[model samples]
Target: MRMSEKRAKMVMSQFKFLFFVLNTTGLYVSHESRDASLGFMVQRIRQMKFVGSVALLAFGHRLTASGFTTSPHLSPCSQIQRQFGHSITNPTRFEASVTQRSLSTKPLEFPENPSPFSTIKNGILTLHHRLRNEEVLQWRALAFSFFSSLFLFRHAIDVKLASLWTFLTTSSSLIPRIFRTDSYEWVLAVSAFFFYIHFFWYADVSVRKASEQGKVHPWRKYRLQDRFEADKHRRSVELKLRRNGEIPSQNELVKNYSEVTKQTGWNWKAWTCEVWVYVVPLLTWDILSPRRHRRLAAFGAPTTIQVLRDITCGLLLYDILFFTGHILMHKIPLIYRTIHAKHHQEPEVRAGDVVRLSMVEEVLEVGFSIIALNLLGAHPISRSIYNLIITFLLTELHCGFDFPWTPQNVVPFGLATGSRRHHFHHRNGKHYYQKFFFHVDRLFGFFQKDDGSLHGDSVKPNPHIPPAWQ
Candidate 1:
């Protein structure tokens, strides 16, 4: 009797342990299956073609098995004795028919071989990746650098060095016959002649800035944030004034514009002014020089011819250098940030602000003009015409006006240029540096889109101000 009782107790303990194992295993397997099913649902939702869908389903099955095996409760043959000791079924076996069926079914369909057009798609993707690389832009930089340098070297004639000597030696025979005449045509002609020689350097700034950096310096961000805040405060103040029946006048408008224009100060003026200062003495020295006879004979002509020649030659030099510099300025950072940044202070530039630039900036501009003139040494006459065309273009750019100019109906083109482009540079000195042409900026993905509105949507045209005050 005692031995039988001990045997029964041991048997009972074994059964309890088996039951615990089975319950644990079942819970674990169920949890795992649920997790795997969630994963499969996610994969199906993505609908990643046929192959990807199949792969995801396979992954789900593997993960479910892993989760089941890792669980302590999901053991096989647990609690079998208690569950079926007295009443055993025909066969005690566990088979996952549902899981097998789901795994076997195809959720996505695809052709064994993709269509022939697939080859074209693959080729396009390959080309796109290749074109996106930085190496592709290197040639652009090199081309810009070469052209800008060429223009700068050609047109850098130091005319100011002899102006003073020419004046003091008015009594000298070296003075041209044109100087004695009070003719307006002759004066206009002379002004036109030397205009290129004198202003070629001025127009070269755009090129030099462009070649140095594809975009403006990053300091532009700070400036922009500041502008936004300042504008906000100004508007608030203006609103308060209007509430008090106060109206802002023309002086107030000018003051507001002045503040906006102060982004870059006239640092270029310092250098240009110095150039002129020393140029006067140099001109005087040249005039008094004993070699004045030969020098005048070589370079001196009617003031009109000289003006025309200068204008034409100056622009030829300017155009090549300007375009090249504009391209490179966006490419090279050090050049753009430090050297080209000074001009960005003026968010809204005016005509007068064009010449009032820093010397460093001016030199870069002038350098390109000189290089361009050298390359176009075909003839003074041809060079002058080219230079004048380019000069007008540059002046138009510098003037901060975007007058609506529609092209011929057949062409259906409009003038895409604007001071707003330059204004943005001044607003944020670092982001949109490329000017004259938006090619480099657009290419590098730095170009800012214009909304054809001032200060973007920030400031609105308030027609009520005048009426409110009255």
Candidate 2:
């Protein structure tokens, strides 16, 4: 039963006892059979309590209803029966006035009809009530961003903007001939990986240190802070072992040491591993790939309009193609062993894992993204620009921070798959294989969490499910 009903029953019992005392004192009943008479009166009150909604009136109570008056003796009062019933207020706080009329019975007296505050509040409430549709708000954000992008693109193309063009032209003259072609994009892509990953390493490690000292994060609410995830996991596991009084095996000790080594913002050994692994394949692709020849021949200084359009298309194409390749790499056991499994080596996807793929995997990513742009007849400058954008995206997707203003959160319609999703893939190795957009993941129903929640803009509440290493 509801709490209010329980409370009402308790109050009713008290009233029954009170009436029995009055009967014992010979105030309402004088006959020797007063107990029997009191029992019947109490039974009638209980019946009315459960069966109907009506005001309760007993001896000497002021009731203003028609054909009801105060009774002086124990008798069958016909007028005490129910007339047109009205709802009774539930007992709250055991207030004495609960069964009696309120002292304040006057209507609200106002001096004005269209009061300034009342008009303003009603107008605001009407708007809030009308805008309760989630789909409408999503569409509104998307529409506003689309029109704003179009205006900027058109303005950039129409205006020459000599200062910006001069700066670029002057810089190109100083650059080497190799970079004048498509090598600049390769350099740009690599540079973006380094800059972003390094920053996250600092942000994450600083926050962790602050927490150890029982200090508030200096500026945590402004920016996303998770960066050194491998170290974070190591610390968490080490803390559990000490707190639970467990003995550690030799293998567990070594694993914790390895995580400690990764705590550095800069790891020369791992950095060396990634660079050589990427460069060997990169040199081979540049020297021999058939697509490079085609890209060099069609290369030009693309207009601002063309560059922006290709960047947009490249992001979409990359998402779909990457989604397919990523899914296949996980589903096919042989492929996972030979290629993609290397990227999953870390307990958590962190700053360093941005380029942690094996040679073949790296080559495929560079190939699909650059070659796809070439197929669209994008100029080398446009391709170079797109490379820079996608590099930042790839780094941040696994950077392990889901800050509100990040590109993942900025995108409308729950599309971008931020660091949180990739973190989930590390834990389960079963779902959320896509990198950027939710389109492919949604179609396959792989967008749901392990517990089966659909993807949304919010971070999945528990990103750190137990690791396989544990």
Candidate 3:
């Protein structure tokens, strides 16, 4: 066979493949579905015809370049190209002809009246553009407020749903007593966990709001005084070192103790191990102790006043226990290094970091609170609400923001210890061991004021101590 015949066969094969692809994929059907307008369909047809003509002319040129002689019985496409003065003999002339033809062919023009569908589409696009412009003009304040409101509303709905679920699971005898115990405990546990996750989201918004405000409110400003003072003192020391022609060592420059030995990367294995170790034992205990579990599982609809009283008691009990544990964890270096120090790993804390703690430490921190509240004869609803409050406060403490509009500032003398205060504790573990109650630290002479005063008196500086006890 001639080389020209082989080249022509190859070109025909390529053309056949292209046609198959277009047909099998339903490309034309998709285009038709995209626009029902007659004008659009006509324009699409014209575009396809132009593309087909270009392809045929190019194929003819390839055949001529391979020294194929033109037969008298020429194909319809070759004849059409010859008629249009696009001969394959001169490649440049053929390209010029094709370009001129393409340029001269004007786009199809539709009637003055557009189709109803097209009109509706255009109207919708205009409305969307107008809304976007309006949103930009208003600085998105309305949109932000709307989203914030929606988030809070959704959280409220979730809380109600959780409460209903808890009530139903605890009250009903649909499941046997053996299974009921696990169900009741898990339902409450899962609900509390869900709320904990939700609080993290809320704290993110709170932090952003605080950043916008640019400063903490005067009411909670006292809580952060010590942190500010420490920062100023550190900077002054650094300046003195620079003046003395000595660069500060890494150890000297360390503001937060956690930063010194902080983990550089996440340990997924440790997290998974801790979760299993923590949850398994708790679940096992609940399953084994039928009497204790049944008593704890008892749910009742308490009065508003009763619920408020339970919350107050729960908060007080938690503060007392947490204060003791926190101080011991610091004083007895073993506990601080092994267990409590897990939470202090993040010097610059975030809202979601609330749950980032040692399994043993978490059990002691949260388990004690729950047990104490249950023993105090608090209703299930009250316990749930208390859990929610504690979760919110903990997340807020780590959220790294002190907005004026926060409940800590809005509610006069609210129990919230403020994020800055807790942040200082993470920075310098030697002071500020208390969580919710500031007075506890003051009473113990652990509270260091912004002016470098300990328990209302000037104190001499102490040397850095190792995290582990001797």
By TM-score, the best candidate is 2
Tens digit of per-residue lDDT, candidate 3, span 1-470: 34556667676667556544533333333333434465554444434444655786776666665567446577534654665433224323422333344443433334445658999999989877875764332434454576567456765655665666465555655543433454454455545655654554454444334535653323222223333444455566678899999999866754442111111233333335554665677777766765544554565434555666888788878888888888788888888899888888866555555667787787787677876786788875576677677766776776555544444444333334556567667766667665665667677776556564332221211222222200
In order, candidate lDDTs are 0.42, 0.57, 0.55
Q: List the candidates ranked by TM-score, beginning with the highest.
A: 2, 3, 1
How do the residues 50-132 of candidate 1 rate in per-residue lDDT, one tens digit apiece? 33324433433444444422236632223332344332232112113223334544222222344569988989888667546
Question: Which of candidates 1 and 2 is the stronger one according to TM-score?
Answer: 2
Name the 10 consecutive residues with the lowest summed lDDT in model 3.
461-470
Off by over 4 Å in 3: 1-273, 290-293, 296-300, 405-407, 413-415, 452-470
Question: Hey, what RMSD does candidate 2 come out at?
Answer: 16.4
Model 1 earns a TM-score of 0.34
Against the hidden true structure, what lDDT does model 1 obtain? Answer: 0.42
- What is the Cα-based TM-score of model 3? 0.45
In order of appearance, the predictions have TM-scores of: 0.34, 0.55, 0.45
Cα lDDT, model 1, residue 42: 29
lDDT of 2 at 242: 78
